[model samples]
Each structure stands twice: as C-alpha cells, then as structure tokens.
Target chain A: MWMGQSSVDFIMAGCKLLDEGNVQSFLDNTDIVLTDCDGVLWRGNQVIPGAQETIEKLRKLGKKVLFVTNNSTKTRAEYVTKCASLGFPASEDEIISSSYVTAHYLKYIVKYTGKVYTVGPQGLAQELNAVGIPNFGTGPDVAENWKFEDYTTLPLDPEVNCVVVGFDKDFSYVKLCRATAYLRDKGCLFVATNTDTGLPVNGRFIPGTGTIVAAVSEAAERRPDIICGKPHLPIFDTVLKLHNVDPKRCIMIGDRLNTDIELAHNCGLGAALLVLTGCATLEEVRQKQSSNSIADQRLVPNFYLPSLAQLGTLIDSLK
Target chain B: MWMGQSSVDFIMAGCKLLDEGNVQSFLDNTDIVLTDCDGVLWRGNQVIPGAQETIEKLRKLGKKVLFVTNNSTKTRAEYVTKCASLGFPASEDEIISSSYVTAHYLKYIVKYTGKVYTVGPQGLAQELNAVGIPNFGTGPDVAENWKFEDYTTLPLDPEVNCVVVGFDKDFSYVKLCRATAYLRDKGCLFVATNTDTGLPVNGRFIPGTGTIVAAVSEAAERRPDIICGKPHLPIFDTVLKLHNVDPKRCIMIGDRLNTDIELAHNCGLGAALLVLTGCATLEEVRQKQSSNSIADQRLVPNFYLPSLAQLGTLIDSLK
Candidate 1:
C-alpha cells in the first residue's frame, strides 16, 4: 500500500505529477478511482480539506466514486454519516469498503442453505441480509452464543458451508475450536474481512482484523479462502463492478503503502497517491519500496501528496 | 487414540478383538504383531509392563517381530540400544518405525530430492540416510542448528512437499513462523510422529511430539498429511509390508488410544486393548467407544488387563 505524502506535499506533488502530464493521461482517461478512507479522507474524524471537493469534481466529471476501506468496525450508515460530516455527501450506495466487500464476497463463495455464523457488526450482517444471506449468529443478547456443541463440528452436515470472520474483540475459544474441528472434518472454507495486521489511529496502533484473524488461524490450521477487504480483491472487484469501469482507467488513492498502495499494485490498476498523514513515513516508504517483500514493481504512488487543500488550486490549473 | 492402556494390554486387547473367540485364538494363529515404539513399547524409555515378555512369547512362536515407531527421535542404534536395555533383544534390522516409513513414504510420494530440511532428531535423519534420502538438517552436536529462514509464517509452498514434525523442544518462534508460512503458501504436506497430546513419566505430564506438531498445525492453519508413527499408519504399514501379515491376523497395542487404539480402529485390523498404566483410562476408552470415535467392527481386545504378564493365565485359558 502507498505510504501517503503529507497534505501539503501531497497537493504540491500531486499537482506537479498531474502537470507532469503522463499522470493526467492517467486521470483524464480514468473512469473509476477506488480511494481508501482511513488515511485519505480525515485522520480520524476531521476532514483533510479538498476530500469533498475532489469527490464532487470526480462526480461532476461523471466518474464512478467509491470509498473502499478494510476497516469493518463501522457500518455503511456510519460511513455515510462520517462522509457527510466531512462535507462529502455519501450514501450507503456510494461506498464499497472492505466491510461491504466482505459481505459480498461471502455471498459469492459461501454457500449458505441456512443462517451464517457471522463474527462482525451490523454493517456486515446487514450487507449479508440485504443479499438474502441468512445471518445465523447470535449476539451479546445471547451470551455464550457460540459453543462447540452449537457448531456442527464432527462429520459436519452440508447445511453450513461457510464461516465468516471479521473484527470481534471478544471472540471466544469455542468459535475457534468449532472452526478448527469443522474445517478438520468437513473441510468447509474460511474467509476473513481483511489483513491489515493493525490499524493506526491518532498515533496509536490497535490490533486490526488481521491480528484477530491470525489468532484464529494459528489455532485452526486453515487460512481464510479470501481476505475480502482492502489490500485484497473483493472491494476492488465491487468498485469496478459497481462503477462499471475498466480496471485500466482506475486509480487507487490512499495514505498508506500497506493498504492503499498495495491494493493498486496487486490489482491491475493505476498508481496510488500516498499521503504522509497516515500510517507510514517517507523513510519507511522508501525502505519498503526497495524490499523484496513488496517488490519493486508492486511499490507504487504516482504522486507524493502532503494533503488535499493544496490540490484545490491545482485543479484550477486544469481549467 | 487408545489411552491409559499399558502397551501390553493394548496388544492383547487388539489381538483378542480381531482374533475373536477365546484368548487361545490370538496365541494359536497370530504370526507377526508389529509394534510401534513411541506409544507402544514405551513413551521415552519408561517401561510398560508385559512388553518384553509379550514380545518374547510372540517371538518364541517364531513370529517375526519389528519395533516400529514413527518417531524419528532416536537413531537405529539408539533404538536398538533402548530396546536391549528394556530386556527386548532388538537389532537395527528388527526395529522399524516411521523414519523407515517416512523414508519409504517420501520415495513413494516425492522423489528423493537433493536435500531435505529435516526437523527431527538423529534416528529420523539416520532412517532417511539409510534410504539414500540426503539429510539437509544440522548435526546433533550443532546446538539448535536448523536454520529458521527455511520455515515461514505462511505455510503454503509448492517447494515444501513434505515436512516432518517430530520432537524438537528447543522450538524457537522462527521455526514456527516459517513452518506456518510454508504450510499456508505451498499447501505442502506434513507428517507427524504420534498424536499423543502429552507424555507421562514419573507421574508428570510432558508435552510430547504431538503437542509440538499441533503447534505447527495451528500456526500453519493446515493439518499434516499423515501421522507417520503408531496409531496412524506409517509404522504399521512398514511392519505389514515387511512381515507379510494380513490385517485380520495383526494386532496393535499401545498406551494411548489417540495412537494405538486409533491404529487398530483405522486398519480394520485386530483388537485394541486399553491398559491403565500409560496414557488414558478404561473409563475414557468406554466413552470414546460409545461415541464411535474409536474404530468400529474390528478386532477389539477380548480382554482388558493392566499388564501382559497376566497373559500366562490368559494363555492357560486359551489352552
């Protein structure tokens, strides 16, 4: 994923990159731009300026606009609310984040004859329910909801074909044990929402869905079939499908190399615009770019931007 | 996995079950009763009563005997040494187990490559060496010599077609990380020695090879392909292939049902005897039996005795 440039440098550098022209050859022909939310829009709650205006400009140009994120803690409604509060008018329909992507991914791969054993919050379940995927799991209202016995562990029947894992701070051992046993006996599939490892916010890093997923993975001996969210594929697919845009015309924008930049690299899409205000630094970006892990070709960012406020004037240059 | 049954009880029970009729049936007709050392003869050199005499009686009848254990924890020389000390006259040729089984299994599955990144002890390495399977692991005196980079956190790699997880207590985190990575990336095969969760000696429980194997399985999110030692198939297969004994005429005996009883159950061979002196109790045996977790409709022991020394009276009854 792209390690974002700071807002100031972002606008200045992005303008230069755009003005440098080959990039405009990129944006001018681009039909869809799947932007990540965590590091792109606002640091946490506050707007980074020009985020709304950029969305407006893209929409005014009749471009498909979708905010795909790996974070599933917030539901679609919360995302819309957050977008509105940040001056960008958003609807549940306008966003295709990891949370939503995971829900859709589940529909495509997980064959559910009955309710699914969900491990995320309302947005995820709602997305599943909207698709008529029966959400079979119980919540806190049903404490001890997940028991080994409650699961069809041994000689598992075909009624339950999938188990979806997401961010749940209080996940229990019983669920893990059941998953392990079920996978062991029946060989049912496993899928996770994302693999962000950890989420960074307000200068503090908390264990992301990846960490939680890894914990269960360490016990179950089965990696999820698909990591549905950002830095993976489902969200990107949904963005393109929903926008009806050719991937060649798509650009991914984000504030981190791990989430935003890596997504663009993995997917056959345009370069990322890494903003420095999020998770990684210039030094880290440079070091990671040279590392074999991310690969030289996979490391991307068409522009190094400090922030979006500077981009407003640059858009004027286009006129 | 037959638990708590002394090794001898395990044998007698398995012999009697498959033999049917009075105890005389086993004594009269049985030719070769191959025994795996890990869960069968002794866990790690503590004697299970009746093992020596039981083996002696069977040998006296001109039965060809082999001490097969999947555990590569000791070398052929070491096994012979251990057996001789236990009052069983064992030679390198007479002692056969998983190292031999795995070496053959490797040849049957994957052609002998240039080198192998072994993860067990000298016995395992020697077994492979004898079979012309080049050992790529470090020497015994090398002091934690296995390189950590060979393994990974994602246990998926096409290169790692087979991994042997035996007894390696100095298990560092790096080994686990690499093993996990290999399992995930390659979907590589894995082979375990035994499934005994814990080993007992001096009335204390010590984590056995199975515990370590479980950790690898957990980290890799993939179960090993075969548990090579007793109760699984490798050791038994070696004996059967070498001794020319029919499954019906054979009997398996061990302390743990997870291994010994499991072997008899899986093979449709002779009976399984539950002895209380080693791993599990008779009570557990009955419980597992009711659940059908134990093998079904095979040779089950016609008798459950604490030790095989009592077999003289049992033999008298047979007469």
Candidate 2:
C-alpha cells in the first residue's frame, strides 16, 4: 500500500532514514514533489552534487516536480533561468517563489486596485509588475543629509494603499518610516513575502526579509495582514489552486526543518523528506523526535537522507 | 497622610485625577520629581504652556526635579541645550536620557572594554565616546549600487564584540547585515536603548529606536541582553545609584502611560502622574484601569492632569 493512503501511524512514526528498505515505497507514495531550491538544489552559485540527477530521476518516474522557495528575492522567470543554469532545468510554471505567491495573492485574492509601496527588491517589484499591479520603493531611498525632523515632513504617496515587505539589500530607515506611515491607515494592507530571519549562503548568514518585517511591525505596532510563504497557509493554498494536486500524494523535500518540514506537516502533505545538504542535522531530527511538544514533533520529517546524492544512488539501484 | 508612607491601599486606588483637593497632598509626598520631556514639557520646538512655570514651582517647593526621557536621539549635553532653549533651564546632571543610561550601563555595569557597533545617531555615539568607549556605525553605511551577493562578502569589524541599537535615520541593510554577523558570536553582547515603537510628533508618527532594535533582534535571533530604558530596571537603577532618591518619594510624570507611568509602577515609586499634553488620553487610562491583567492595571497612573498648567495654577492658589 502507498504510504500516502496509509493510516496516521506512518506520520506519527516520522524521522526514519530513507534507504533500500523504504526508498521505493516513499517514491511510490509521492506523485508530486515540492522541493526547496536553496539548500536542497544549490548553495549560492554552486549546485549540490547529485541534486540535479535526483530531480531528473523524480521527473522521469512521472512525479510532478515543482521548485518551491521562501526566497522572495527572485521572480518566477528569474528562478527558472537560474534553475536551468544550475542543471535543475525548470520552467517558469514549475517555479513557485514567495514573490510569485505575493503577487498572485494581491492580484487575484485581494483584487487590490491601489498602488503598493514595496520594501523589497527588483525581483519582488517585477513580480508585482507582471501581475499589472502598480508598485514603487524597491532600491535605495535614503535621504541625503537627513535629520530626524525631516521624517515628520516626508511626503507620502496618497495613492498607496498597500505595503509589501521582502528581502531588499537597500532596506533603509527611510523605507521603514514610509511603510509605517502607510500602514497607519487602517484600510491599508500589510503583506510580507516571508519571515525567514536569515539567509544562509556559503556558511555565512545575512539578515533576511523577516528582519525588515520585524522593524516595520514594531513601528506600525501590527502584524502582517497576510504572509505568503512556507510554514504558512497562503503559499500552500496557492500551490493547491495552481497545481490542483492532491495533498495526500505530495511530499515536500527540503533541507530545513522549521520552514520546509514544518510546512509539509502544516499543509497535510503525504510526507516530508529531509536532506543534510543544508541547515539541519541528524542531531536536530533526533532532538525533535525525542521532544514531547506536538509542534516540535511536526518538524520531524518522515524520511532523512545524507544528501540528495543518496536519493539519486537509491533511484539508480531501483533499476 | 502621605500616600508614599501609606500601605497598598493607596496604590490600589490609582488613576485619581489631580485637582485642588488632591494636588497639595500629592506634591507634599513627592520629594523628587522625574518628569518626561517631549509631550510633558515641549512638543517639537514649542514648549507646553505653563510647563516651565510648573517646574519652577516644583523647585521652589524644594523638590529635586530631573528630566527623564526614553529618546536616545540626543545626549545629555544636547538635552540640556534643548531644555534651556525650551525654557525648562535644566543642567546636564538633571538630564537622564536613554542614550545616557545605555553608556552608563555599558561602562559601569557591564564594564565592557570591547569596541561597540552602534546602530544609532551621533548623540548616542557621543555618549559612548564620552564614557571612553570606542564605537562606530553611525550615519549612512549603505553600499552604493549594491547587490544581494555583496552582503555575503560584507566585511565585519573583528574588534566589535557588542552591538548597541538605538534610533538611527541612517539605518540601512548593510548595518543590519554587519550587526547580525557580529552577533553570531555567542560571546557578543546585544544592548538596546529603549523599545518605544513610535515617536509621536505634531500629530504624526516616526519610527523609534525600538523599531531598529526589533530588526536587529530578529536578525540576531535574540532579545537584547539589557534594555536601558523605561519600564526596564536599568534606567531606574541608574537614577537610584546616581541620585540616591528613595523610590517611595519619587513621582514619575509623563504623557505616556506605557513607558513613564508603567516605569513608576515597576520601580515602586510614590506615584505616577499623567499629563495629557502628549500621546495618551483619559479614555486609554480608563481602559487600562478596567483591564483584568495586572500588567494592564500597572499602566494606570496614580494621578492625572489635563496638563502641567493645571498643577501650576493649583500651586499659585496654595501660595
């Protein structure tokens, strides 16, 4: 019997390492694969060894593969191009970035007509623009020779009725002040792409979109109206609507537990497969499994692999 | 009977409005007056009516008056200048700003000798410099025409072992990145001036130090080790050590209940007097008084006045 159709007992007994004993059954149950891009497929400009082959093997086995990322720094088109260059060979339609969901949510779900003041990057802005939504405030907007008093008289666009926050290298105090001013209006919408605190790159960390969102939330004294990203319902809902995939037949494969694996549990996916090519370690999985908290237990993925290379080797052995 | 010497019965009966019947008794019990500037004394460049006269009257009655403010944008010297210009005529010793408390705590309490990475204005840096602490990261540290990839290679000061956050108009992504990197070390110290979300200025609001702190905290994945501002013990402890005033004889007066009034209650001061020339309103006081939570009830001041002008009139009438 496919694990997707099995009882809740299988999910409860999570954190089992995938090998010859169970790799075939895991693949048999998963008809659709939602894979996180960064740690699973690539780290910075370098692609993880055998990740490309694993994704290809999954696709060849008739599994519908989708590239899912909490990163809002890149648009779907940009992601597609990057994926191709990195050997993942993805199409724009096969990519579901946080930025894409943000734009989709605003355009289709909210049906917003007003201008947006975005505290993000060119990719986020491009996503919004692709959906025919008017937006501004992407790059550096720092005031020259500014005083604290200048903030009081800072001119705000009267047309902006929404504020979108994401990852922006040019995030500045001026942008924070502007966002707070717009968000002060009760009717104005506050949308965040994701709340991932830090982005890990080549063994280093940089402040992520969540840092910027935290600042804006503090100043506005309010949380985001909607967050369209992993471990949150909005992104999953978007995936469900766009792909029309059965949740029971889907497995989310990623490296991080809190975001990728927790998102799998939150969305009622068939199973979550954790790979050790990124942030999480087996020690952490063991800790989560031993923990009594249900929230922590949910972060325990159904299967673990040393890396995507192990999955590729297992698939080759299946032949 | 002096309410300061009275039992818990007097404190339970908080939110009493000051009038002719109660004003004299309230003052007689208060040996030291801790008054907040901005809304209580002045708003922007304009001083509150009768505020100067009220301070004069308090001093003439032999009360030791000190200016207590959560604002970290200005140092003690700047505050003294601002006070004299606004007719309050305060000396540097009477000025207790959050910036001053931050420097005091780091120099005297933590006894930290490491270079500080500050995310604040010149005044905050000046205060730290005054205490012989070497610091940097003031003004705009933004990367011109920067890409997200540049943040990965962003150089961090190896000598910086502490990150002090306050209000900074020049706050940018580069500063947030660098702060996060330095804070990754387990031995690094994280300190914040205050957590006031917004600074209400002439019917408008600007982001405060707390906003910046929130960003840094989110990125660093830790709360400040010490927040040297209102409602926290640091600033009040500084006051007690430097001035040697009994908490039971010190009354806190301010426009905001959350910071000033809550600080008084937290420190077990004689009383908290709300002057409604600033952010808070009587309606809010009533709400806090009616709240079931002890924390909410703590925000209820012992007394309230329409403004300091009423207190001045009451003093003249007594004379």
Candidate 3:
C-alpha cells in the first residue's frame, strides 16, 4: 500500500506490521525525518532507551534528521548543550524550536523593527535579543500595587508595537495591562510561541504556554496574528527552508496525535508514525481509526509502534 | 406603559426622551434606585458632574438608594470612606460589592470550613478574614521561580479547599502552580469576583479582574463555579437580602448596558435606565435593540437619558 497517499480513514487498514522487511521498506522510502523531543525522545530529563541509537543509525543510513520542539523555555544554545550532555549531540542549525521559530519569523518574514512587549520568561527575551530585536516586559517585577493615581499614570512603553506570548511564569496584572493596552491600538502584532494547553512534567500535566496565550487573547479580545508551534506550519516551513528538503520524502515521528501527526498532515509530509511513549494511548488510536467520523480522521496516525525502542530494534535487526 | 413588562425588542421604542414630562414619568414609577459607582456616580476619584446631587435629591424624594460596585480591590468600609470623601457619602450597609458578595457566599451559602487559596489583593483577603474564612496565598511574595524540582516540591497548603480569583497585583507563576495543583484535586471550588474584561481608568481601559480570572481558568482548564458580580444572581441576591427591598419597585441606573442594565434585567427589577456616560454607546445600544438576536434582549435598557444630571433636574423640579 502507498501509505503516504492513503486517507486517515484508511490508516488502520494500511498499518505496516514492524517486521524486518516492513521496517526496511519504510526506511528506504524516506530521505528526511523530523522528530519531536519531549515525548518520543525523552519523558522529562532522561532520554528514552535506544532513541539516540535509532537517530544516529538513521543518520548513518543517509537520512537527514531535525529536532523540532515546542518547549520555548530554553534558548537554542541551551537545547544544543542539553542534547550533547544527554549523549545525543546536535548542531544548533539542526534544532528548530518555538522560541527560535518566533525569532526567525519576526526577523526574516515580518522584518519587524519595533520593540516587543513579551509576556514570557527570560529565555524568549534572550532569543529575541539574539536576533537584535529589542523587547520589554520580560524580566523581574516592576509593577507596584495599583493606587488611585495609578489609573492616570500606569507606566507604558510607546515603542512596543509587537506582543509575543509564551509560557510566562512572570505573568502579572501589570504585564497583562500593558499588553492589553498595546493591543488595543490594533497596529501591534500579537504572536504566540505555542498553544499546548498543558504540558507533561514528571508524568503529570501542568499549565502550559497555551494557557498564557489564551489569557492574553481573551483579555485583548483578539486572536493571535500568528502562532508558531506544532500543528502550525510556520516552524515546519522554517525547518524545510533551512534544510532545503523535499516534503514528499520526509516523515514525522512523534508521540502526540494532535500536534505531531496533525503537524505532518498540515505540512504535507509523507507520513507520521506515532510512538506510544507519550500522551496518546493505544485505546485512543483504536477509537479514532475505527470511527467513520471524518473529523476524527485527521488525528489517525499513518503508522504506530508500541514504542520507539521497538522500531529501533527492528531497524537494528535489518542492519 | 409599564416598562418592566415591555419586550426587550421594544426597549428603544419605549425609551424616554430627556424632556420634563418623560423624566418625571420615569421617576414616578420607581421606589428603590440602584446605581453603579464607577461610571454613574464617579469616574475614578472625581465624582461625575451632578451625580452626588442626584442621589441626595433621590433620597429627599424618599427613594431607597443603594450603591452597587464590581470593584473588588477594596472592602465595603473602604468604599464607604472613599464615597464619603468624594462628595457622595454612603454607609457600609448601603454598598454592595463583589468582594462582599464572595465573602458572604463562602461564609453563609457554602458554609465552607476549609481555608481559601486566594489569587487576589489585600482587600479580598481582608473581606474573607472579616467573615472568619481563613485564607492563604494573598498579599505578599511567596511564590519563587519554578525550578525543575518544583514540579514535585511546589508548596501547597493542605487546608486550602477553595480558590478565589480577583484582581491580584501580586499574582505570579508560583501562585498559578499552586492553584492549578489544588484545582486538580476536583474537590476544590473555584470562584471569581467578576468577568468584566477591562476597566476604564482615566479615559483608558486596563486589564481588569476578568483578565486575571481568565488566566487562572485557562491554566487550570476549569471554569469558575461562582462569579459574584453584576448580571450574576449572587451579588444582587446578597444586596436584596441585606436591604429587604421589593424587586418590582426597584430601578437600576447606570451607564453600561451589559453590566448595570443587565443586572436589573436578571434580577426582575422594575426598570433599567441607561446613562450616556460610560462603556456602552448609543450606536451600540441601538444596534443591539434592533437586532433579532435573543441574546441582545437582556442588554437593552428600558429607558435612557443624557446623564444622571438630567434625571436629577427632573426630580428637583418635581419637588
């Protein structure tokens, strides 16, 4: 079966059993591979067993690889350091993150010149600063208690014409006030890093960047002008442009159905392989695939394995 | 015509012109008058022109007057002090506020025994304390930067079974984490003061209590169980019970259609008179009334005037 052209409704019918022959055929048909970081590669800090070996083996087989992530809490340099320390060393150019993509979009695509009012952590600020984009409202607290006079004299920076929101731990009423006022002008561009409602940490989910973005959007009464994250095309388009890769020869491997699988679908990638190592459970995949509902079709994976390690073992046996 | 029973679609059709005859007729039909503080009586510290005189004249004409406010940043006592200093002296018992209503709900209605986790300022905490509801997570810097281990070690008060959200100047990431964790327990009650998206300050809008509430709600992935503000039954119920007034003889006067006028509509009050001083404009009101949408019906005021001063003039001439 030409699994790449098969509809999501036919995904279950075309499920390739991970025999050595099936694995070798799937591997030979792909030239470029994109992978998600947190779930498919590592749970929290520790890397998944054999995930590193599989990527390296893929590289040895002449396949191009890229690490695409939604975590905007760290700079690309920090991610590079983290990869190297975890025994999966990667170059800065090989990593595409929401934080990095936001900077890239602001600089190259939008050609923005004004200061950004960022409702995020220092990491996002550092990325913007690295691209020579001046930003405000990111660091330590400067907002005081609101008094009667504060109504007339709330501090505002007029130079801010862009507001970028991410996973902001330092989000305050003052920052919210400033961003809302700036957005009221409508000339200001509103951008968000990702829309992951909650993030997994230590086997549990906590509030994520999407929560912060939702708050700003609700208060401003305006949806984001651009959202650079999974299930969106900006980051994937950036990665494709940087690597100069053909979309038809690329496959995305991730553990999330909504973000990873749907991202590949949105980007016109060849296929998406779900590894049962993160948020989606096997029962959920079964429910989506067997259903005749067209809306649920987008969430069905092109292929799924019990774990990335199982795929790694299959590929190793082929070698 | 009895405007209280008039169709919302016919609100503008029955609107009283600011003539001596029309104004006198509107005054003659009401025994209790309820007014919003911020936009109707005053705009930030400076009382609106003729507002105080209008209230004094209403009282002289033997109308039972009460001040209703959504500002949860201060206690009823503080509001009394501010009102006294601003030329419109009001007693503590005559003022109904969101903070007061929230406290009353928790203490009397729910009879909550556990401590509260408050994501608000000193005023909300003080009101909760006055009602003997012990609360934590207010009025200081307790939340620190989240470390990786914070996922497991975030400080949480075991006794906190309710989370009250309002306009908190001291809100931070640590508080968000704590609240999210507490809410995940499922037994905890989530409450908010109001959901007004923004508040006008010195002719400009700033992010208000709704902004803060939205942030917490998004992060928690839960909606507030109780929102004790204008147009909501809790605050109005508290005011009605405290004053022992007849709803059918009451009239609500204010500038905002969505909040003040809707509050009267929701309470089954006798009439709603819109003043052209605050958020809603004539064009917007006319559009809402003219539309066939049922949702817009609650927002249409029974009558409208140029200002409270016009109503004051009508009453003085009657005297």
- lDDT (0 to 1) per candidate: 0.58, 0.88, 0.80
lDDT by residue (tens digit), candidate 1, A1-319? 2234332232223222334345445568668767777667787776776777877777777677777777776677788887888787877887876667777666654444455666555666777777787764423212133321233332333565666777644333334444445444335667777776555444433445665466456545557877887677667766655666656567777877766776776666755666666776676666654565535435546566666543444555564
- For residues A1-319, could you state the per-residue lDDT of candidate 2 as single tens digits? 1224332454578688899998888889888899998889988889999899888888999999989999998889989889999888988888999999999999988899999999998999999999999999998899998866788888889999999999988999999999999999878999999999999875778899999999999999899999899888778778887887778788899999999998888788888999998899999999988998987887899999989989989998895
RMSD of each: 15.3, 2.9, 3.2
Please report the interface RMSD of model 2 to 1 decimal. Answer: 1.0
> Each prediction's DockQ?
0.03, 0.78, 0.52
lDDT for model 1, please: 0.58
> Which parts of model 1 are misplaced by more than 4 Å?
A1-23, A108-115, A138-158, A291-296, B1-319
**Model 3 ranges with Cα > 4 A deviation:** A1-25, A151-155, A287-295, A317-319, B1-25, B142-145
- TM per candidate comes to 0.50, 0.95, 0.93
TM-score of chain A of 3: 0.92
Candidate 2 lDDT by residue in tens digits, B103-151? 9999998899989999998989999999999999998898887766787
Candidate 2 stretches with Cα past 4 Å from truth are A1-10, B1-10
Tens digit per residue, CA lDDT, model 3, A1-319? 1225543433545334456756776788788888998888888888889889888888888988888898888888998998888877899988888999999889988899999989987778889999999987776563565564564466678888899998876776667767787888798999999888887777555778887777678778898999999988888878766877767678889888889887877776777888988888878878887778754667777788877888778877885
Model 3, residue A223: displacement in angstroms? Answer: 1.5
Best by TM-score: 2
- DockQ of candidate 1 against the true complex: 0.03
List the candidate numbers ranked by TM-score, top first. Answer: 2, 3, 1
